[model samples]
Target chain A: MSSAAQGLRRTGSARRQPARPAWRERPKPATQAAKAVALAAVVLLVTVPFLIIVSTSFASNAEVVANGGWVLWPQHPTLNAYRELFDGGIVTHALWVSAGVTVIGTAASLACTIGLAYALSRRDVFGGKPILLLILFTFLFPPGMIPGFLLIKGLHLLNSYGSLVAPVLVNVFNLVVLRGFFQSVPEELYEAARLDGAGEWLILRRIVLPLSKAALAVVGLFYAVSYWNAWFYASIYLDSDHWPLQQVLRTYVVGGSQLADSAAGDASAVAAPQTIQMAVLVVATVPILLVYPFLQKYFTKGVLTGAVKS
Target chain B: MAIAERDATGRTGAAGASGADRRAGRKGRGTRLTRLRRDWVLLALMAPGVAYFLVFHYGALAGNVIAFKDYVPFDGLWASQWVGLDNFQKMFGDPDFWSAVLNTVWIALLQLVFFFPVPIALAMLLHSLTRDSVRKFVQSVAYLPHFLSWVIVVAVFQQVLGETGLLNNVLGDAHLHTVDVIGNPGAFKPLVIAEVIWKDCGWGTIIFLAALTQVDEQQYEAAAIDGAGPWRRFWHITLPSVRPIIVLLLIMRLGDILSVGFEQMLLQRASVGPDAAEVIDTFVYYKGLVGGDYGYAAAAGLFKGVVGAALVFAANKVAHRLGEQGVYR
Candidate 1:
């Protein structure tokens, strides 16, 4: 480094920086500037692409083309793209499909996982250890894709929505989390409840569920995000018409196929396919963004506890 | 639920508290039957999940028998002509399967070298920040992308880096040659690794960040008092503290090396062609699901599964030899 620049960085106003603990040394201004730049880059790198998609989705057709495909910010924001999407067309149907699957799938997954985790959390439940062993072994060597597909085919779940949720109803990781959280609850509490003649379900409902709200929310969010984002299974299992939003987005947007004009009746001045694609992207993404923030803090606890265990 | 305090008729009143203790001494079939009758409700609770694992996981697992059979759909999975090692021999000879294996390993290696340490570095940087609000805000923004579907992530990348994408548009305005990335086979690997990094690097920081947060402040303080600088403190305290986690995660990653983002590659496989994107999973998808070559595909998949399971066992053995807890007991 140049001596002058080094000297300036060393002598840069430390007053502007936050106070550090006595044991910690203040970083040089150059280091601070570099850190700020790195953080900003990290933040922007993640956020800018989403911004461009949203901006272009909302941008008018002329503005998008004028900017040569994508607009960073719209000159005149319009809801036409979303209007086309929600015009009771393929995308609208897909959105509903996705919402239904996420809701129903999350509920089903949470129920099964809770039951299994709670049952297994108790010390001497019949066949608890062996059942856990059976489940955990699947984690080590999961069923091969081909065999799994054949099983689905054999079961006649070829075009059924149950194909999506049934195979993946109870995620082992989420089960581990709930099990760990359930196990952590005091034995004394279970003792107290059992003394009062509380049944296993009663204790689980009254004590375990209330205490495990954070873990449940996090697990529910994971399941919802997974179901929402899933398309590959839908691609293989269901027909295009029954695909969720993610699968349709994959086909039309990423696959570069055009949306059929007849689905969205009239007034279709034919916006750029890129705009429509971005609009679909936003629509597919908004649900996750809406639910994630509320359940964000619980992620650390839920993930770490489960992760640490296995 | 709380209102129902009815206990089972025959079992002890304080059943659960002494359940594990009593079971330790009792091994009789009579006790086992007693235990079964006693825990019927719990058994009922576990029925759905157990049935799922049994049917979907193990039952599908049993379907691997088709790997040794010809798997004629008309003759059915069971009555199909047995092929013994014929499918394996075909998979061994077929250059496409080998290429898919090669691609999977190549991608997995690329991820290990380029994508593994990202969250570690990001975690350390976030840990060093003094301002709580800045740290929290940056974290919120950073991990948000992890929630997006691969389809959306791929679209975002295409929108930004494709032929007529933003970068090209800027280059065209400046009269510079626009780079072709989306379709360039050579760029496919880097593009994939970049997407993985962009989508998951932040989320990956969670474990390492948790590790860092648990580091004792006194270690840094003591290091400073001993005249150790920032780099020295980081090397001595932070690195050593998270080393076990890093090593554990590395072992887990190495064990599952054949998996290289199947859906992500499948989404973009058509754009760049299978040569650039056919990992083992995709190969199986195409060969089995799409092309109807069930027996051959199942053989290839079973091969991958066995190798993966063996690697996990080998890695776990190594972990135990090194005195780490490993993935499981």
Candidate 2:
């Protein structure tokens, strides 16, 4: 009787608690304050360089030079660096190439990966186990640089846009993740479709694709980012004019080419290398920043579930 | 029990409906043909995928045999002269190659030690937060760096620490002596490690976060009721829950000790000089691709691959012995 009464008392006391308490049982205001401070510190450490660049990109040459190469906030922010970059046509052209590669590459990758992942997901599919082993074996022993490069060259793919798309169309890791996700779909769904007289294509298009949206999105994002950031292959397979924005950024930032010759600008503004580099950095990062928030939720679940494999 | 019986009935019914499928199995030779015939649609669906592997993956694997020969583009892979272990010997004798191997191992070890724990710590902090909104906000902010390119990452580091960059500028403003951080060999290792942590530490938290979610809330409640302190409860409950994940990640990381991030190292190699930054991947790129010493680079590549596979096999064996579920069967 006392135990029942105690249970009732505990339930009553729990109901009395507020919907959302400002603080929990520990009451570590000092600790939370310290954590908040520490988190802010970490964020600042990661973000300050970014801030400096964006601020410096707009700063006047005199201010930047006088400030000994950086301005925390532009004394007078200007779009002169951007104007020069756009006028040069190189940055504009490279931007288009990068966007094209990302779009085409992502589309091709998604289609092939989905097709493959879907086929492999079905346990009763002919030769599925061996095919999966074949794919997984590549992850274990990746084809070396010389061999991979030679294969591309042998196919007469050098200097062709197809080189970028064809060689890396389907990442095995992405494929495996997608396959795992596809496999997780209830067998009853496939059976239901089969009973409804749906063929493999109809079932894939109607049933599988809808269920695998999160996996597809995550895989698509990985492909797109990889294509955007890829410069090594472009360096090997592409001519100088055909290089992507990353390669262009690499040339400017790492190679230390002045933005002056590209445009006959006020040497002072162009002379501030800090802002110019930051402008490039911002350009490189803008695509990811724009797309990341929308796909944030998929990342938490989609990534790890896919990553459960070795 | 009823469901199992019903499933068996359904299976038998399905088998009865597909008479030819069952009948063909009675004739052993015909069963193979029937199985192939039945899966024709699946094969059609899988054609492009198989073609991809054959062309890109297996095709590339076949090309690795050139490591045994003196490869010439004009003469081609098959036509090249056979020079068996000479390439491997050259790679072994090369001091530069040895140093690259050393640098890769050292950097990987540092990352395993320093960068590995930060994500777990961050995840714990996020887990402990009372407000869900705050935790989500912190995670969103932390994950931003992971998506940024290594070029941008390197550029960010350079703009902040390069000669006439932000750090020196700040120091100058304060009337303090400037420090040369960027392009300094002494600081290069720390710079690479820091960049890696900034870029990937948050991404690493995803697995840990997933692992943490499976922990039962009732355990925490019981611990609290039992008057166990937060620290004690954390040690007893939370750590044990996530221990397998930690062990699994460590084993996987150990297997990949030779492959530090390729693009990151490649980008910074020129700045820091090859001594500090030349890892196995970059060394292969320079020697095989740029210098056209295909055999030597291929030999080195094969060597790394062999070691990696061996390590994975060993790690799996060890995990099984320890009574833990490993990466593979």
Candidate 3:
């Protein structure tokens, strides 16, 4: 989000068009106010609910119950819900599972995508055309859900972390984006690298990867986000003990399962189910929030580079 | 956030760079062996991704043959008994299947009517803002929800609109009639659409905003010079500029219309009952996975896949007729 703003600041001075050009007149005060109100409504529609979720997650149990399950402003904010969640129970176990999947899955996905994208971007590699065509064909007509589930079963991937990552190891969209970004590197650079005795792998590591940091970051973030957010396959393939955070949270929060056993002890140890649910929601949300600012700066540059150049 | 464009032909990506050189550089049959030997490293680099597609995509695709089989737990995919269209006959005659189809089509049409044009309008609104900071802030906030999982989004909505949720609480205080939304059958379609709007409308604007930026300032200036008002200027310049992309997206949406949010519906299906919320994807899940009717469910899924692929092919043909790039050439 801030990435676009940073792009604006970086290019604002060099921008050719003025805010109000000579041929255009400024709008009336009423119009400006209406526009402001509209923009504010858009922002509020997004933010207010999020603010309430975060606030209710920290509110004391009594206050949350009194507020009828959604606390706007927590007068007595407490960390008891989060405390109970992390008391070595299901939420804690699932959190580690999600983290483990995210780290391993993102790394594997990025590595495979980089290799394939780089190979496809180059000219006249043997079998590259056929391979690229075959992959792109699958994008048009994806494999069906039942067959996909059956495959996982046949492969004995049921209830394993491998089921989460192996089946979706390389996303075609990310591959195409990286491929487009790689192709944008001038051929002259490749020639110069070759003259200096650089092999393909070395060229990739030293030249292509360094130059394509923006795109790489964007793709990496995408892989990470998808892995973290994934639960559908987890629901189908994994047992409850092996489930990821999102899947477990789905049962407790959306499925409205009992919260007393979600943690280690009796009912008194946990906060209100409402607050515990909100806490789980916040835990599921925080990683994305933590990671967004760093890579979001590349959104415009990375996306446009692929789209325009390809 | 992806834009409207799809790279259907990888050849076009390389077309601009090494079109002639590739033909000349790696010529006839003699050097083909040499070229293969030389390019082994590149092929080695591609092995993991290539193997992934082979095993997961095509492997699963081949597994679709079960649609014609009576699947047994002990008997594998190839070993299953060939029932030969029996599953399809059963699926076609099922009233539940037709009802699911109806629900899918009705929900997709609602999305087309409500969820389609939001981003375009939001993009235009964001574009018209002269204050760069405000525009950036709004874009950032609006796009935040798209990152959330369906589980979380559904939970948030339930928290806001469930029987004991915040909306009812506020209404109770104000002594007004409270609207029941989350699990209500009549409100399901609108609730789903609203969830979609909250999550994706902001992210969808990125493509249109990119298109809006590409509109030459001179065109807007020229329209203003011609004494056109803001609305007329938008009609003449802005709308025309984004129309191509809008058409491209609509065609693409048509291709994907049947597949609604499966996990989303699955999460809330028990609360509202299948009559109100069952679509093809969730129906496949419940029938095949939960209910243990593998062959019949695979048939339903195969039917959906074939129709969806046909729609894409037809949509692409229409795109070519319109002289625009579709999902493929």
Candidate 4:
């Protein structure tokens, strides 16, 4: 088709035009150096604290104390702090709680979001526009903290794990993102599926979901991260026994409380509090660090599609 | 057609009934039944999401009624005595409430003035990178902090800038005066603003970088060919292209100005004390949850919610007047 030829010609012209355009000329040496220095500063500002935290976590107790509570690099790397953290105590329990919440919540959230988004993505679906607006309106005027608290209390969900997941089951933003992605599917494909006598559910199961794996992964990661990072709800709703890791982290680390209290035993047997704190920080942060790179490339496209379309 | 005609005419005439008309009528009813059957699955699919909104959002919205009542835990929400704005009257007269409002507005303004432009500048910096690989590397490193929980972020700040933290340690080693950045009430606002900038500026740049990409390469080339310098081209072409996005974000920021970071302040509030750190949200948490003055706190919260919603509407109106797309049409 002529359209294919035009696309080829466009690519050909794009390739040719980039060959030394005036705007593409290299900047002056001074300007280049300044840019490099500015960028290096930005990179350093972000990376140094992480480096320090990792180093301190690995540092020996004596070295950490001698270095005045932080180590740039470990003199003697040890797993003593991490070992203490997982020795079946508060941190251990909280880690399990956080992991369970994240996995189950992400699955549940993604399922609900996909179901709703897919239904809404179809043109002329009954009451779809009203439902979409109803959802979007919540974003503009959120129920404040007090009322939200009261509702949770009234539901008798206080001091319960359900408080964490039930109150924030589906993020409207994620739903909107998935809806936009679903809407971008080609109409002709739907017609073809319909011609084959496939129902909406069959088409969704076979075609739409398979095609939206990237978006699903991205939204799932977002949900997972939110559930993992949530501490405020846990702080308010759950008692100390049921607190998740971030809430534990908030209480002992950021709140500057005694580690012995949170660890639920005598303080004499444990390693340095600084080391344990850094280890806890490392434990809290490591999962996101591990998963970030693989999903990093999807961030722009995934977020922008939602941002633009919505 | 004959059966339809008979039905429409309200005549009982089986002899005039045609096969096609009977079939058409039956087919119409069949299609309706089929459509209803098909829609049921979609409805079933949408049920959970709709129920979540209804129970969590709308249901919580209904609970705002407790603001006008003496909310007793034993009596529950409905059985509580109605005091009809006594809670609001108490909140309006409370000096502590005013102080919290002052702190919230002050911090919000500080963030607006200082923290708002960071992402734009960072985006411009990244956008100007001629090498794609370098841009990618820098971007990956930059956005890492945004994903961190405020707990972790506050902890990191404590470790690096606390009284005995890295900076103080380094200063002590260098025979310099050590500074107390964390836990210093005087430094809390700036410190919080700095934390906000460090955590979010890079992630914030995503939209602006996206906006930057939409700037026309042809126009830049044209400007360059006409001897327009880099700065001039950027000012003329790039800034204008991203201005609408900047405006849109500004409106959103204004709407959210009342919040000014609840979790961030909450984490640090006890250290600095409420005088320097009590934003509206933290104040609400302390008074309602900790102090158990539920009715008064709920009234304050309702006040915030209504003001926030109004601000959003007003900001959107302003945005529309300025010839930009607001959050909604």
Candidate 5:
């Protein structure tokens, strides 16, 4: 009856239509070949730097420096950088901390976010409206940094790992996307669950979540990426010893530090500093590279549909 | 348009509220309360989320009180003496503060001018690709950088372009003079912008790509029938179809002018120095938390926050005036 409600109805229908344009037809074989070449060129441009980083990471220091600070393909590629990184040093400790934080943080964040989003998605759920408003209000007026830090401090979370996880447990954008997805599930499914004497939790676990896998994968990947990449909170809250890989990378690469402890090597080992730095870059970026392919299938449609409706 | 509908709904809800008010004094004055009492199980499930917001968000909001206080660690916030307007005065008079503001505006403007069109162009290019597999593969590669941390991105740039890095190494082999890009004060802004484009332009394509999907196939077919060339069809059909999304994103970007990537600048600040790298965010961090000048930093931060909010509000209002759908209803 309400226009906002009407718009919501229209949006759902619009999504279902898949509106193929009549004028647009499949391309000719020649055009398709041309398109493939252009696309490959774009992909090549994006991939080259990453390839350079990876290659240089494995390259010998002499080879790296001799080739004008590049090692397109290492003459004598070695696992020495990785060997040094994992051998009980600052980067080793940082690597462990980053892994722990990402795993623990992503799980906690995904759970809390899904719980809140699902509750809000249900129109019949009691206290949902006020709760939704409370959550949404935070989007409009985010807390200032000082207050956030102070609150973390007051909770005695400072210098602790919990500070990194607690402050950003639920991203509002992710919550909205997840909620939009849950809302799109057919109402008949919920009714059928109720008829079968299934409770909300059971329905959520068996029915809702199963159906929303694509969305969950996308949102989960988003959470994982953000958590892995995060350094600001860790920089402010944790001691330097407890710093994550990104923060460690920040100190070494951006701060331009050349002290070889173990990650790059001892000062006497003698390697190209740029190569060592590139090695660190690869180490930091590898997690994202690992998770991308699995989620790439759902990304475009999942992200676009979720974002546009909001 | 959405707001007009919302207003009508709210007006009707308001009318319904008076009827509920009249019934409230009768037999079921406490019915809603009774309903709430029955919903305790649901409340238990919702408690963590509610508590999370109460502490992290609202508690932090209450922490803004430190903006008026001296904020000594031992004394704590409640015990600190209020120093009204001193911080604001100091912030206004600081030359570094002014430079940070100017730098922020300049970078944001550059992003608006140069960086903004990248995603649109990228989406167009992707949209034009005839083969779906080729288009998707390109997209995956383009989106890769967005996943990297700022630390990694900066590191990548340094390795490729720093004085003794790959570019220099290669140039030396060819007997060419090295050109500095990374950490150079003159090149800092452009480098930062370039880094942003590399990392985010593809991600930005998400919205434009979505818009492109909405363009009617019939329109393109009609243009082809009219003997229009590919370029003419693109200009007539595709660009206009995606115009609204572009306008909407531009307005949103304008509102975020004060924030030109705090972490990225902070990481690079030592090399480029504050003169070139300082933005409002770094300025606030240095003034308040890092320098132990809480009140002044808060003032600077508060100023940025207010201005950002005002910009969003103004932009949204302008969008509404132009008969466009803004970010919110």
Candidate 6:
């Protein structure tokens, strides 16, 4: 046996083979403790704020005020904040806008990206090299803000929903990701499909896409998240009545604007501003939290493939 | 179509006068035609994306003409009077613009110094873990914040560190003095950098972790048998393995130094005022879009873009000099 294998076996005899290489002796206690501390710090740093946000959103107004604007954990959880949020006002409307934009934008972006990426992945496609360089050149030197804003204004998309989608229809990074995944599909499978007289669309649908579900899901999630979280375009292009949930969150929560005017006529005068703001933050964030785990499974594979191949 | 087809067939016919020429040229043109015809579906599929780039990117590029014009909204782009370098000259003379430039550079340098190495360090910590489940769970938790919008991230910070936030609450309960962090002009740069590190350090680790996984197992084993300890093995094996990626990411960071969080800064710009918060992008937004000084704003933006593009080229050249591929060929 090779010395490495023998060493591993010898280490195996002493205890378990180290989860990494046999070279790692069991980590010294200090190393173990340090790692544990680092892990705990990371987890707590990420989770504590979420915990506070959710808890404060569910806390009673009196409790929130008494606790100085945040609740680590609610004494009595309540949905009153959420009810007030959806009481047919700006937050509810913005939530619908966010959902609609995310759904439509993700679908359109994924379809366009997949179609373009599939086309570009083919070796015999006409003008592919120049087209790719053109796309990539934009990545290097993006069109500046004033010009972009002017283009949107010129196209009469300033107040339209198309302002958000049109300006960022297909991200080149996502395109490259999908293209890398498509190129990784075996040439033999493509040749086989072509030999069967399958058209490009059919090949993409029946062959390429099926093999690319992980990549598509990851890229789709990216599009969905960006569209969902987008506030800047909405802030600039649309009026207050057409803002998305993120923009609403930005205005009320981060912008520190009192919602008293927005909630002026609402029946739920009992809900505190902190509660409502936290509720809005949670509502804006929850959809991504829900979708993240599934797509996260593919993130490493998808991103690495895209990064390495590109 | 008719003219092209007739030309093609006529050429084939002319080539047909010579047997060998006819076979080669006719076959070549026929296959080329066939290939062209076969690729129509792909071309059609590419149309939306191609059109999107043309209209949004190239069309926007064309709109950069306003930088040279004394633009009036009533007169529109074409009717505006051309003023040559007047807008640029104005920008060069504006102290606010220079302050914004300085702030941008300051924030970017702080991020480079403080935030850049965090992921590499975190990746090392995660890579040393002996348990799979712990590592996976930590990775998932850490990467979660990366997907949160900057608004949410900033709000999270406010909830944790603002005057009436968790930190103050704890301090109040303990009868201690409270620290003002959120909206404090003096603390704005560090606060923004801290937020960036919190949001991205985990996501950044993804690439380094991937690099770590690629470090050869044999190297570690060989080093261990040779009496090297963990730190030595890590220094000799792990760091060297990920050096190329680290350099690549560093170059990319250098190229992007001018853009130090537009949305994040915009969201907080009002809180800290322009003195502490203004950057090139926000300056452009406020000047051009909000203030209606379109020509001047466009000029400032064009300057930033030109310098940024130049930086990218220079950084790429430096990378090539160091025997790295950098971003492109």
Candidate 6 lDDT over A1-310, as tens digits, reads 1221222122232443435554568767887788788889999999998999999999999999888898889998998889888878888888899999999999999989988999987654777889998999898888899899888888888888888888889998889877766766755566677677777789899998998887888889999999998999999899988899999899888989867645522855688889999999999999989998876776665243334423
| Every candidate's chain B TM-score | 0.91, 0.89, 0.93, 0.89, 0.88, 0.90
CA lDDT, every prediction?
A: 0.83, 0.77, 0.83, 0.82, 0.76, 0.82
lDDT of 1 by residue, B1-329 (tens): 00001111112234445554544323344577798987888899999999999999999999999999999899988899998999999999999999999999999999999999999999889878887568777888888999999999999999989999988988998999999999788899999999999999998987777666556676788889999999999899989877877778888998889989999999999999889999999999999988999999999999999999999989888888887767765
Predictions: Cα RMSD each: 7.8, 6.9, 2.8, 9.1, 6.1, 8.4
**List-wise, what DockQ does each model earn?**
0.37, 0.35, 0.54, 0.40, 0.34, 0.40
- Provide the TM-score of chain A alone for each candidate, in the order shown: 0.91, 0.86, 0.93, 0.91, 0.85, 0.91
- For all predictions in the order shown, the interface RMSD in Å is 10.0, 8.4, 3.8, 12.1, 7.1, 11.1
**What is residue A5's positional error in candidate 5, in angstroms?**
31
**Which ten-residue region of model 2 chain A has the weakest summed lDDT?**
A2-11
Q: Which residue segments of model 2 deviate by more than 4 Å?
A: A1-25, A263-273, B1-30
Interface RMSD of 4: 12.1
Docking class of 3: medium
Q: What is the TM-score of each candidate against the true structure?
A: 0.92, 0.90, 0.95, 0.91, 0.88, 0.92
Runs off by more than 4 Å, candidate 6: A1-21, A261-265, A302-310, B1-34
Comparing 2 and 6 on lDDT, the stronger one = 6
DockQ of 5: 0.34
Candidate 6: true contacts recovered, fraction: 0.62
Give me candidate 6's TM-score against the actual structure.
0.92
Where model 1 places Cα greater than 4 Å from the true spot, the runs are: A1-19, A264-267, A302-306, B1-30
**Model 5 CAPRI quality:** acceptable
lDDT per residue as tens, model 3, B1-329: 12334322342445555643544333443477897787777889999999999999999999899999999868888898999999999999999999998898888899989998999989999888876778877888887888889998998898888899878989999999999998898899899999899889998887777767766777878888889989899888888778877877887788887888887789889889999999999889989999988888999999998898888789878877877666555
Candidate 5 Cα outliers beyond 4 Å, as residue runs: A1-41, A262-273, A308-310, B1-30
